[model samples]
Target: MPTDPLERIVETAFDADVRSCRRPHSGSVAETAVLELENARGDVPRRLVCKRGGASIWTGDAIESAVLRVLEQRSDLPVPGVLASGKIVGERGSARETDPLERWACYEFLEGTNPGPGYATLEPTVRRRLVADAGAHLGRLHGTPGLEFDRVGGLARGENGTDLVLCEPTGWHAVDSDTLREQLPISVPPTGDSGRRPVLTHGDYQPSNLLVDDSGAITAVLDWGNAHVTHAEYALARAEVRFVDSYVGRLSRAERRRLRSLFRAAYARYAPLEAGFDRRAPLEKLRWVAQSGSNYARLLGDSRGRRQLWRQFRRLLE
Candidate 1:
């Protein structure tokens, strides 16, 4: 009934008095805040990051908590520890469709700064190390044993309630196959159930989700809302676009290539990319381009963005 229910949830979940609660990030689907905690016997100060879910087409706090648990137990990736998780009291109507409870997961506050949006604007040496470190961490994550699945989708509970299963990928919008062909004028074939085993991927892997210290070392990887089961190479291809190619209109061809090289080289130390990656990357990258272009076309009411994406998509095809 209150305007914000997270404070109540935090107090109930941790049984601690809150010093301050400040929302650090609030998106369409979730609100995240850093809560300063004060317990009865003040041994030491504590800070926790609490994420409360809102309506969205993506997996919510439960899956995020599960994914973090798996990573904490299985891999060396520096993800925030799940300190407390529970449903937000009296906040049911604003929940995700798949999940009944408007769940929230609080994490032990990780130290570092989010390497903001200006990846291309960073000093060249700093950019190089950060990219390489991110690539290596991703490689290690994909290589973590026993995380493989058979399909592309978000992680969900199986029928028996003990195992994990695949559900529809978050942010996967329905695109008409017939119209896609007309827009690109090229055969954008569906990526088949490839032979490669699917692995858990950081669904929204980008610079924003990574945190770094002053020395540019990655101290933590944040945000698991988009983690999904997918082919590792497909994920890598997507990363190449986000980590490397997203700056296409601005960065020259050579500059982009250099960044890609740094990323792949670091990634290769942990896991080898499958064969024919170059040929397959374009196809994989097109999937994102089309989906994004479709969303853009809806907002712009013109073909300019689509046409530009078309040119870029075609270049990748070549």
Candidate 2:
């Protein structure tokens, strides 16, 4: 028996004879709950997860659910099945307003913990295998040839194909334009290449998004809110950074080197390394990095200070 109003929303959505609904503290953008539903006709009930959208960062739940449905129908990727979704109107925010400030979607609960903790204890061989498998999955996503969406039409449907870089205000912001240009060593297009060709991308493909069973095999990849079609190289870069960031602290110096080598090797096997891809090119890399930083600041910053920080961070990275 839950007292929270949101918990009641979960119970009502499932029409589940819910024995209990326990909220889980895992994600930042959405409210997640693990519900135990009782089946009157059978001995065992059902266990499902519910995700309710929050303000600021998670305004795309409806669109994300639609995209996930499309992906599950077309691709063999293991994503959670969407159950139901709608505008949840309630009392909150303003007295003048009739609806709540948030929207929500319910999903079939996935059973498994995050791969981050488990990955730390993995044997060298196992880690290599996981990396290789992840690379393969990424390759398949990137290699989904001829996948197209009507850019103009998608926008109408609230499907933003471009990666949103929010600019926010920060006190500790440093690194000037020249410094940023000097640090990054890669090429950046005026606009992202994703608009040109649309390939499937799990917008955020970090260790936390992957789920592994007791034996350590990745059973499912959750969270499709950020998944969309994008440029292959951009997606690859995102994946590379995620993989590296996840394992960096846990690995020894030698192991870190080996892992990087393995990651690049595995990635290249699927998509040949671009001839002039230079990791040391500060100008290009910094531009992208700066864009990312600015986006973060913008999302978290208030209107008055957001633009200032965004400009400074962008210039510094550029």
Best candidate (score: lDDT): 1
Q: What is the C-alpha lDDT of each candidate?
A: 0.67, 0.54
Model 1: weakest 10-residue lDDT segment is 53-62
Off by over 4 Å in 1: 1-3, 25-28, 40-45, 54-62, 89-101, 157-163, 168-195, 292-318
Candidate 2 has a TM-score of 0.69
Which runs of model 2 end up more than 4 angstroms from their true locations? Answer: 40-45, 54-62, 90-101, 149-198, 245-249, 264-273, 276-288, 302-318
Listed in order, each prediction's TM-score against the native is 0.76, 0.69
Which candidate number maximizes TM-score? 1
Clashing pairs for model 1 are none
> On a 0 to 100 scale, what is the lDDT of residue 206 in model 1?
85
Give residue 222's error in model 1 in angstroms. 0.7
Query: What C-alpha lDDT does candidate 2 achieve relative to the native structure?
Result: 0.54
